[model samples]
Target chain A: MAKKRIVTTTLNGNQTEFLCEPRQTLLEVLRDNMDLTGTKEGCSNGNCGACTVILNGRPVDSCLVLAVEAEGATVRTIEGVATAAGLDPIQKAFLEGAALQCGICTPGFIMQSEWFLSQNPKPTEDEIRFNLAGNLCRCTGYDKIVRAVQDAATTWQDHYMKNCHEKGCH
Target chain B: MRDFEYEAPTTLAAAIELVAKHNGSARCLAGGTDLIDQVRVGRLTPDVLIDVKKIAELNVLEHGATGLRLGAAVPCYQVYGHCGIVSDYAALADSCRIIGGVQIQSRASVGGNLCNSGPAADSTPSLIVLGAVAVIAGPKGRREVAVEDFCTGPGKNVLQPSELLVELKFPARAANSGSHYRRFIPRNEMDIAVVGVGASVVLNDAKDKFVSARIALGAVAPTPLFAKAVGDALAGQPINDETIAKAATAARAIAVPIDDMRGTKEFRLHITGVLTERVLKAAVARARGEHVDCRIGH
Candidate 1:
């Protein structure tokens, strides 16, 4: 028997610590040990983005990350996206656009979309499609999802630009 | 998945020492995009995983006057979008852009892709066509091997168990030289290549004759094989329909593909011909200092 590895990560704005087997995935650690189940697992091979999470501000499939590999890193799961009073803008737009059906893939999609919007607040339709290529939703045929992303982009741009203007970048 | 010990060493020397300490019981963990999945599937069972992501030196892309030196731990996304090396080596950039999805790209390191040594690896042909050299660090010390001779078979590489890929270096393209890469896949994204081709060409004045050439083919052999015969055919010839046809035929003759789930031997052979023609044309256009559009319709 091999020794269990101790991992500490700042998960969802909280300092979280857990012990995992060497083979334990970050997705498993989040769901089983940490009790943060918002991150789901699908197709454990990384084909499906159901286990997506923001690792150090980049969206990566949780299933593809070893729990031990994430030591001393910061992780943002779906549960961390919303504020105390409201959902994130992308999540709000997703709800407004009715972009989800069964909702199994929504968490991952939301996380990925949030990262994409951060990089490009005013993404064109083509840019949105390209950025979202890794994330898929079996439901909604992606039409409504694209619409939601576009809506989020507009909101994000207006808010970000206004904030930037207020900061006196000019 | 079986249990194992894990260690994340902050320094390159520490990472190498950890792997050596564990001997054959350890594996170097890169992006974990491929290593983790393999571990969960029981295809690999290293008793210890030496995480090398914290080694900053292994994650750099250094550019010099002659060529580029890419750290092994640099992610595909970094190579695709961030590295200046890609701007000059368009074929490598294009290949990185098509590897898996954004999430995979974020975690999949260029070194892991090369060290995985899969015949279908997207970066293999790209590096091969550009004449890249892999720098490896092991208990014995450091050594270098050409990318063209790095892989021995499926999932096999020349690296010893104690060795870790440290860096990848390739000469920058000379003036008037252009490189192009293209692959045929069943789907638009998140799929492996059924047939991949990368070609680099140096065009003389007016793009009349090829001063130098390199063509590397992937997914049709045990290793990513350079199309030396095709390169020979195009080396001194003018960019013309006749030359392209002959080069394509030459490339087709080198492949002996197998029947697999992604594609059949017959289809793979056919694609080798088609991709050869496409890449050569695009490479020629690039060699002439013109932007060659290689984007695919979804």
Candidate 2:
């Protein structure tokens, strides 16, 4: 049997350690070992963004990342999005806007949208659609999903303004 | 996917030694966007996975007076992220932005795209037209291969076992030069190219006449083609639709596509001319002024 390799990563704001074989994907590690099942597995290939996670500030499909490659990296899965008190602004927007149906792809969409919003806080509708093209929603035909992202962008902007009293450049 | 020994060596020499020990059974993992899926689908079975991202030589991203030195492990996001490269090598950025999405670009590297050597790979045509070269290192030492000559077939390249692609080197941008890449796809995003075209052009100081040009076509052939004659035909010709059409005809003539689910041979043949004309026009516009044509891909 191949020996399992111990990998360490700052997962969801916590120092995480897990053992995985070379054959296992980060998606598998997140779900099977860490019990962070929010990052769902869709195509198991890179096509589906259901396994999306923010790794080292970049959104990536977890299924495409080898488990051992997470060593010393900072990873933010869907599990890390919501705070102790309540859901993140994007999550709240997703719920309020009814951006999900079937629910399998919601986590991935939220994670990807959060990262995109961080990059371009005042994104236009075309920009949102262009940036979020990797994330697919089979149920909503993407109108509601785009609306939800727009909703989050506006709310997140307001939330930011209320806190800092000015627009923060990303 | 079969279990394999994973090795991440921090230095070039150490990585070379580890891969050399595994002989031909070891595969280098740069970005794993294509590779991990290849393994998961049982298309490939290897005994070792050499994670090359840790090696400094494969992560060097330097743009200097001479040219751009893009490390093999530098992801696509980093390539497009560099403002200078984006302006100087607009075609490279054009293709990189559309290769996958942000998620795939964040993890996939341009060097890995070259190494993957798929016929439809988005970056190859741009690499060829931009005159990029692969800097490879192996136990036998180092050698450079032009990007146009790198691939021999679909899913194949000139790289031998244990040979590592260190970086892709591009010569400094020539004066009055501009480049652009665009592909015909059925969908707006998340699709492989049907007939991709990359074009780099140099125009007269007035930007009304062609000084010289380079064109490359993808997905319409077994390998990405450096359409030298197509570019040659447009040299000295006035930068007009009629002159560009001659180059497009030449490109379409050389395209030998196969019928597949993505596109029929005739469809690819027709698109070969269309994309060539479109990309050439965009490239000419950029050569006149360092502007990126966002309209090309859409």
Candidate 3:
């Protein structure tokens, strides 16, 4: 085993620290050391987006990232998608749209969709499909997932505008 | 994966020194999308991993009147998302946009792609057609190599043990000139190219004839090859279907593809001709001030 190095990062909304080997991947550190297992690992080679996480506002395959390399970065995983109020709009939309069957690929799909919708609030069907191509869902065949993203986009946009108007910022 | 000492050097000089000390047992990490995979699979066992992303010199992405200087560690998403790069360097943009899925694009760097030296790297043909030069830093000093001549064979390049690819510089395109890249893949996304073609054409003032041209092919040779005969034949010729077809035939003649699982040799040769024609037409359209959606998809 290599010498364990302490890495401090901003995970979700909290500043966190963990001791891990330099060779351990971000996915491994998140799962094993930090005990945040929402980010799943399907194919560790990065072909599948099952280990997706937003690092410093950009989504990346956590399995392909080293723990030491993310020493000072901010990371957001599936576990951070909701708040104390309730489930996020994306999670709500996924449930309403019935976007999962076996549910192994749901976390990654949701994380990726959140990143895409953050960039393009109102995306076309083709854009949604193309943007989410990295995530694979063998059970759902992707039709429901696509609809879920569309639904989330509309719901989230409406909610955002409503909040802005209530707060007198818009 | 093997355990190794990880060093994040803030300066290029320190990185070079670390590599020199480790010699054959060190690997530079910039966008570890590829290197991490190789290490996990036991293909690479470097005793020291030098993280070069912390080095300021390897993280620059600048565009000016002279041209563009893209730091070797700039991610693919950044390359494709830059306004000037997407508009002026269309072929490079096209390649960058489709290098991998969105996650991969956010992490993979074009410099890392070139250094990986894959035979079918999506960026090589476009870089070669754009006349890009790679700036390399080593223990001795610095040197520049044309992108076309950088790779010697599949998985092989001309970098010494203590050398690092610093950045890539591309000259500004001439007036009335445009470049485009296209690749044939079995699936629409997240698939390697079976046959890739990159074409850059500069039309005359009238937009009726080819003033100058360059074409490069990928996945059909050990190293991406320049279709010199095709470019030469198209130069000074009127822009028409007949001339384009002749150039496509010339492109087919120069391809030396092997029979791989992705495609057969005959299929690759035939698709090379098809893609050459399509890519040239698109480049010509762009040169004539026509809008073309060069993004990867149907």
User: For residues A39-156, what per-residue lDDT tens digits would candidate 3 score against the true structure?
Assistant: 9989999888999999988889999999998899999999999899988888999999999998888999989987777677778998998899888888998999999999988878
Expressed as tens digits, the lDDT of each residue in B115-211 for candidate 3 is 9998899999999888899999988989999999999999899998888899999998899998999999998899899999999999999999999
Q: How good is the docking of model 1, as DockQ? A: 0.75
What lDDT would each prediction earn against the true structure? 0.86, 0.88, 0.90
Mind giving the per-residue lDDT tens digits that candidate 2 earns over B5-63? 88889999998888778877988998899999988788888888899999998998888
Q: Which of 2 and 3 is the better model by lDDT?
A: 3
**lDDT by residue for model 1 (A26-141), tens:** 99999999898999887888887989999886889999888887788899999998989888888989999999999989999999888777676777887787777788788789
Clashing pairs in 3: none
Q: Candidate 2: how large is its RMSD?
A: 1.9
Candidate 1: true interface contacts recovered? 0.88
**Model 1 lDDT per residue over B1-298, tens place:** 7787778889988988988887778888889888887887889988888888788878878776788888888888878775566567889888888888899988898799999999999998989989899999988899999999999999999988788899899996787888888999877777889999999988887679898889999999998888887797787787898989888888999997889999999999999999999898888887776777665661
Worst 10 residues of 1 chain A by lDDT: A161-170
Worst 10-residue stretch by lDDT in candidate 3 chain B? Answer: B289-298
